[model samples]
Target: MTSAPLRWPDAADPVIRGDLTVAVAYVTPAGGAVVTSVSPLGLGERENGLVGFTTSLGFPKKLERILRNPDVALAYHTREHGFAASDSYVLAQGAASVDLRPSPERLAELMRASGPFLGEVKRGPLWDWLLREYHQERVFVDVELKRVAVWENLAARGAKAVTGAAWPHHPAEQEAPRNGTGPRVELAAVARQIHRLPHRLLAYRGADGLPVIVPVKVTSHDEAGLHLDLPAGLLPPGGRRAGFLAHGFQPQCVGLGMRTLTGWLTVTEKDAIYAPHTSKGLAAPPYRTLLTVSNGLLAKYGVWRAQRDGTSARLQALAARRPTD
Candidate 1:
């Protein structure tokens, strides 16, 4: 007999329906969790505990990474400019299944569903050609949440967790391999880069095997690492590897700047310290035209790089399960 589909709490609908973007964290092959942002356009019918976001096929590394490890988390920590009036933060942890090549009909359905949140889609031959790679060449990832955590406020402190299915029993945690306890990028320098950005988030794998993302603030910094103030009752006492992401974006992803880091975090009654390991990011020109041009160039390069690395072939293979209709 088949099992029933998982379902999230009814209270989570606001976050599922209105949040502009979610901080999606996926685990890497080396057991590190990486955080990135994706808009939940249309959100794929929030029935049966399913929620999703679209990703470009041009960036095949992202697809391959998810395929390698479906375990993921989405944090709906922002309510500004969205239909939801809820002041709370909702986080969903689940496994992902990718739709490699959705049919055109499915894409149109998404466009219409997205209109309320993203406004109208631009048409005409010029935009159509320019943004074909972005609009046409896309895939979807569906995450069926196993656990949903809610915080009374956006701070993500003083939170509670609700599970959709029976919780599993896992063994005592093993220390993840240290990839150079960081501050490798210079604590002061890294702080300078992300300090101005309003959104500060840290991602670490939870004991239940899901990557937990929490909003954080920089308390202070030393030559060794950056100290952070996180929500209460989160982050177990001890040391572990974590990822930090600071970003700012306007509507349509214009005028955006993001910085990410991998590091080691040690938590104690006194405080939690984050040591930055490696870092990379970019600042896009604020102008829409310039950003579009930049995206076109990057998409082109991404396709070539993906093809060269055989990621394109692997992605196509995943398309075999695409919808027939």
Candidate 2:
């Protein structure tokens, strides 16, 4: 008995004018041997117009179902004509699998193993062009036996071929915060105080969902100043505004050395001061006389002068009450 020649579909004669060749291979998972296909995947220009051809095949539903069950197929196609040819290989479902490139070493290993299969097509100017256009360092060939059948018809008829390209994956990076953890303010307390203030307090909720408060203080140097160290949790997102308000109020108060009929008051370094009875240069017939009077008034009125219409008015009132200027 004589062996039968491989049968292929009857198709139009493919126009091949270049040094390009095309080849294809098909594999089936159902214990079927790999079926090889070869073609001249190319196009040609004619007086009438440009002519080109492609040979492709479709598998039956039964074959597809069988492959889906766990069988795999491999397919490969290559064409060598003169100095140029097309090369391609595919791994059908279940035929082969690929994992993400691990380390540079792993990637290099894979490249080395695939180097021969990738062939000399990736050398010289062609390699440079591949690098420039596809941004790829190496190429790999995967064979799919089962799904390979689809292209059998194409290979048998000799169709024009083209190359495909892809790139590798990269990881992402993150950054750290700059300033060391400084003091933060208590947000809840600040919010409550802001709410109580007669004037609207500039308030905002931070990313953590806590309210930030504006600092308030007396500016006078000789006066007792209020410095509230807000709890850290309430600190504003950006400390600029809060820091400004806290420090900006420090210069308004008069210093302790200034002469006044009420006497030379002793101001603390922190800007707190005690009322005096006599001017710094003057000697009092009664040393404690003015102190006693001021203390008496403060006790009865609860420092009413601090809230007076004006600082000058408070000064005038104090001077008038003095025993003898």
Candidate 3:
């Protein structure tokens, strides 16, 4: 609901001061959104008023997407204790460029910015590997700050406030299914498929009111919700407002076929549970789950094209034979 300009290179910004890899989100060539992590080898505010970071030439999927569509978002997270934490994240709605062969001086600057996070690359196997395998191909991704949405204490403010950008926001409202509006026609079938897949990401409001994402292992997903096993410290004490996305991916000609459910999460006696909220592919209509499934299938075509033959089939088969599904 609010906008601001980014003030970079400040000693106070935890993103700059702390040594952590931020989750980066970007749109795929096929228009699907993908979230991944990147460790900045070098970072700082530039004279031109932009924040820059260095990453290896690895991850061709990300590199290709960045070159085609420069719009991107970055999230930084910190925890004071198991329960007290906040997300101080920034969204940069702008363009990014890749410099495949950065000059020696530039590479040094990037490495220095990364510091201890990049480890002591001065010598040892790490340095030797960098020189022999990766150094020559390293690239710098410089993001120009344009339209920005920054939440200093995201958990305290609530995730809803920062909902308008490329970052997938919470669904507005869940009304009863219209004649043909909600979920899929074979809700049971879809649910079976979803229950067979793995947990993708877990969500929780950080102490400051921002959404916190934790990758989790789901033991089960039944009428009650998702049963998960995660690190004890990852969750706050007691029930809290949270979300989860459990998804399976299949490759197609355009992008990917994704079966996913987004839901509210809470801690229970034996496991963390995710109660289905708004979903695509797996829920029954009047919710239009079919369209979500269709779109995801199309979007993943690009990603699947890069996979080996039968990979999609194997994943589909895996989803089909779950003991409870």
**In candidate 2, what residue range of length 10 has the lowest lDDT sum?**
247-256
Report the lDDT tens digits of candidate 3 across residue range 76-121.
Answer: 4332111223355444344465665579898666656544453333
Per-residue C-alpha lDDT of model 1 across residues 240-298, encoded as one tens digit per residue? 77888888777656677788888778888899898888887868788877777676666
Q: What lDDT tens digits, residue by residue, belong to model 2 across residues 1-325?
A: 9433212111111212322322222222321122222122233223322222222111122222222322222222222222223222211222221111135564445434333322222346644443331222211222222111122232222332221111112111112123322223333333333333221111222232111222122222222212233212222222221111111000111110111111111122333222222211211122233433332333334223323435324333443443352
lDDT of 1: 0.76
Task: Give the least accurate 10-residue stretch of model 1, judged by summed lDDT.
Answer: 165-174
Per-residue lDDT, model 1, residue 275, is: 86
Q: Which portions of model 2 show Cα errors greater than 4 Å?
A: 1-72, 79-93, 113-325
- Highest TM-score scorer: 1
What 10-residue stretch in candidate 3 is worst by lDDT?
A: 248-257
Q: What is the descending lDDT order?
A: 1, 3, 2
